[model samples]
Target: MKLELGDQSGRTAIITGANSGLGAQTATALADAGADVVLACRNTDKAAAVANRIGAKARVEKLDLADLQSVRDFADRIDGANLLINNAGVMALPLRRTADGFEMQFGTNHLGHFALTLLMLDKVSDRVVTLSSGMHSLGRLDFDDLNWENRRYRRWRAYGDSKLANLMFAKELARRLEASESSLVSVAAHPGYASTDLQGHTESLMDVVMAVGNSVAAQSAADGAMPTLYAATSPAVRTGGFYGPTKFGGMRGAPGPSSYREVADDEAQRTRLWQASEELVGITSPV
Candidate 1:
């Protein structure tokens, strides 16, 4: 089923990772719906290519999610953003740290977007959509060692943790928005399993198997982008809602309410994570 995003005229949408994959597809849909899109990416050149294909309604900007300074700089330049899609991320990379020396997946996937969203809260008028994953089911909160500073880093576990954090962040952000009595909403969505270059970085044998499956059975990036666009544009979507595919354990289908591990809904953990994230990112609640 195709996503129907109605008029978004004169509004601006900032989408991270828009140079390719789901982000690019989401940007295309929004631009077609009349929203001016800003592709926030680490490489302006690659993003520019995506922008060219998107035509006049889409533009490019430098945004490195691994670097806090880059987030700050990018937020500084933008005045108003009607939609902020925190869609950029790294999956299971070996053992790499962000520029801020935090665990790569957790830092880039969770904290970077956390900082960016908080910093841009004043400019955002409508919604914030963060991309999570079904792998979040494998995750648990490790409050004492979020950065993996002392723990032995298991790449997949770390990735799961980061995606879990994405959901928690969205829920907490939604709560805060309510507290602040703001009209803006925070939502989360997972693309399920989409065929995209996002899988190219991992070298595990499982990666090879998954790549084969993706080539044979996975949904296209455009289909994978549906849930995110649905959460972003659908009036039926509520604050703190999480969306994904409706079939095959949420691996593929049209957009709907997605299942998440019960642990992800822990209110206390969400609060703790919010506090820890603010501490790690060196700030208080933007709300």
Candidate 2:
């Protein structure tokens, strides 16, 4: 069946980092679906513009996933949401700590979204979709150095770790939902090499490499967002499913069932990671 996001009249969605990149495109598509989207972003001004462009039904809400208090505040503001798109994220950036003192990439990419997802679980009814990446294939969880404090930090490695965590979290959350007998669904989607500001965030050397590759291999932000929108709204999507591009190696094509990282299927890691995340974020959801 075609994954169409139309006729979502009274449904509401909260998209983290919805001001730009895949997030912005997803917000626009969801608005087109007739959903009232909350553009949860760090930059209010940029988010406002995105909401304005999407239509007046879109609302801008300030959200910095890096801070627990900010996550709490954002969660509190939500009354009920039909969809929660964990679409906002940070990329390969230099070593920096978030407001909560976690490494920047892991903090913004994984933990921030982790905390937000848990905080908003009760508020969300139908589904939650997390944005992961293909780099997840190369990653292994470093439980010994979860924060990269003792080990030497590299940008791409940290990014891969976070992306891997995203998939793991999505899967684990699905399992938890099943155990709790909750109807809420959790799924993951990735934009394979999409052209977005993430490339601009890279170092100059890597930027040039990405810039060249992007011109040929990357899809536009709107195309990149299709899988996410599909996962969020498609009737055919099953809980715990992953979706992405359907072309060669999933680079670009119509949204479809996507391959997953083998590591994400490790039951032990999924359990351990879930417990650790719950402890770290200090929130326990029936899931």
Candidate 3:
């Protein structure tokens, strides 16, 4: 079924990484739908440009998900919001660490969003949407080696692990909110092979390969952002549902309920990841 969002007047949404790509598209779409949009980004200049294009309905806020302190500060600054889209993320890169010294992908993609969602949970009146990826099927988390400290680090595998964490975090958060009898819902979505700048940043020859793949197989960033927008705004969305492209092996198509790996449904792993994330970010029992 094609999903179209209704008028969102009186709703406020905060989208991370709103400077470009899917985040930008989602922010623009939501603002056009009459929701107040906050472009929470690391680069104020780029975010400002987007906000300008979005006119008065959009504003910019500086946020660096790689830095836990930045996440805390941003959470503190926002009074309240109806929706929070945890859309900012880093893909495959050389073994690097976040400001808090965790693996960059896992730190920014999962932990940072984890902390931000918890810190801002009380203030959010509606739902939380997190961006995951199709690559999450390839992820296998080793709690002991989550940071790649005990073994060799493969950039793609690390990225997969982070995306998997994003999916599990959403599910676990949904469970907690339900258990706590809160109205808030948590959901996740993936951009199936969308052409975006995320592929151009590997700083390696894979960039060339991905560029070719983008030109040949990927959909537009706006199309990729649809699943996220659907998750964020669709009244039909379930608390823990995952949406994505529903055709061509989930590589590109209209947004819908998409398939996920069996591993993603592991309740034990979801609980463990949530616990581990809480310890890593120094937060507890957020829901």
List clashing residue pairs in candidate 3. none
lDDT of 1: 0.92
Q: How many residue pairs clash in each candidate?
A: 0, 0, 0
* Candidate 2: regions farther than 4 A off: 1-3
List where candidate 1 sits over 4 angstroms from the true fold: none
What is the lDDT of every predicted structure here?
0.92, 0.87, 0.92
RMSD of each: 1.0, 1.6, 1.2
Q: Which of the two candidates, 1 or 2, achieves a greater lDDT against the reference?
A: 1
Distance from true location, Cα of 72 in model 2, Å: 0.9
TM-score of each: 0.98, 0.96, 0.98
Q: What stretches of model 3 exceed 4 Å from their correct place?
A: 1-3
Model 1 TM-score (2 dp):
0.98
lDDT digits (tens) for residues 159-224 of candidate 2:
889999999999889988999999999999998879998777866588888888888878888899
lDDT of 2: 0.87
